[model samples]
Target: MITVDTVCALIAKKLGSKATDLTLGADTAFDSVGLSSLQIADIVYTIEDDAEVELDPSQAANVKTVGDLVELVETTRAAGAAA
Candidate 1:
């Protein structure tokens, strides 16, 4: 059920007023939106906490776009459910 919008909303929620000027979409690159590495890490941590699952750090490092994060979240959630 994890979708791009879900991830985008999470980012918006995390960033608060800082995200107001950014347009978020599936293809939106984190860097394009002016997200720093620390911001990205914070977002990833938020996702992990919200999902109650620990994502592979290596896999998280490869995420570049909103779609990529959504895919990672979905994959992690599915894997957790299967287990």
Candidate 2:
């Protein structure tokens, strides 16, 4: 039940920016917006908890945007449900 808007809001809150400041596009780079490793980890964990989906830590490290995080969680949830 996690929506893209919710994810974007989470990202904005985590980054300490207004949601309007982010484009929430697939190509937006996290580092470009000042997201550090610790912040990214915190956001990822929050998403994991909110979505109730476990993500691979290795793969999570490679996520670069709001869309990437959404895709990762959706895909991981799909794969888990399939299994």
Candidate 3:
């Protein structure tokens, strides 16, 4: 059920004041929003924790956009449920 908005909210929460003026969307690149690698990792960790699913580190590393992170979360959640 993870969506782009969910990820965007997480990013915004992490960014705080930095996100006030940024327009977050599915296709928006992480770099475009001025996200650092550490920030991304923290967001991913939060997602994994919230979803109660551990995502593949390799796949997580490849996520570049909000949509990508959402998809990864959904996919990982689905796989965990299926198992």
Candidate 4:
């Protein structure tokens, strides 16, 4: 299972910020890190690289926060395995 802590750590590494800036809770917004749209795309790419999973653009579009992203990744991974 992909834990929120692991997701936060990855986001921290990708954004070059401390994990302390992030929260595992649903209220934590990705934009709260002060990353731009381009940065967010790069973050998605980085997640794909590290997690070894390709994210659908549609699903990626739905991610607005760390928790939203974690859920997307988990669901997409499960669907990928089921296919």
Q: Highest TM-score: which candidate?
A: 3
For 1-83, candidate 1 gives per-residue lDDT tens digits of: 66788789977886789899888999988888767799889988987887777889999999999999888988998998999
Give a tens-digit lDDT track for model 4, residues 1-83. Answer: 55667666666776674556555455568777766788788877877776778889998987998788878888888888999
lDDT of each residue in 1-83, candidate 2, tens digit only:
56667766666787664555667655667777677788878878988998899999898988877778888999999999999
Q: Which model is ahead, 1 or 4, in terms of TM-score? A: 1
Residue 74: error of model 1 in Å? 0.9
Q: Please give the distance, in angstroms, between residue 16's alpha carbon in candidate 1 and its true position after superposition.
A: 4.8
Order of quality (TM-score): 3, 1, 2, 4
- Candidate 3, 15-82: lDDT as tens digits: 89989999999998887888889988999999888878899999999999989988998888888889
Clashes of each: 0, 0, 0, 0
Show pairs that collide, candidate 2.
none
Each model's C-alpha lDDT?
0.86, 0.78, 0.89, 0.75
Model 3, stretches more than 4 Å misplaced?
none
How close to the true structure is residue 49 of candidate 2, measured as C-alpha lDDT?
95
TM-score of each: 0.82, 0.80, 0.90, 0.74
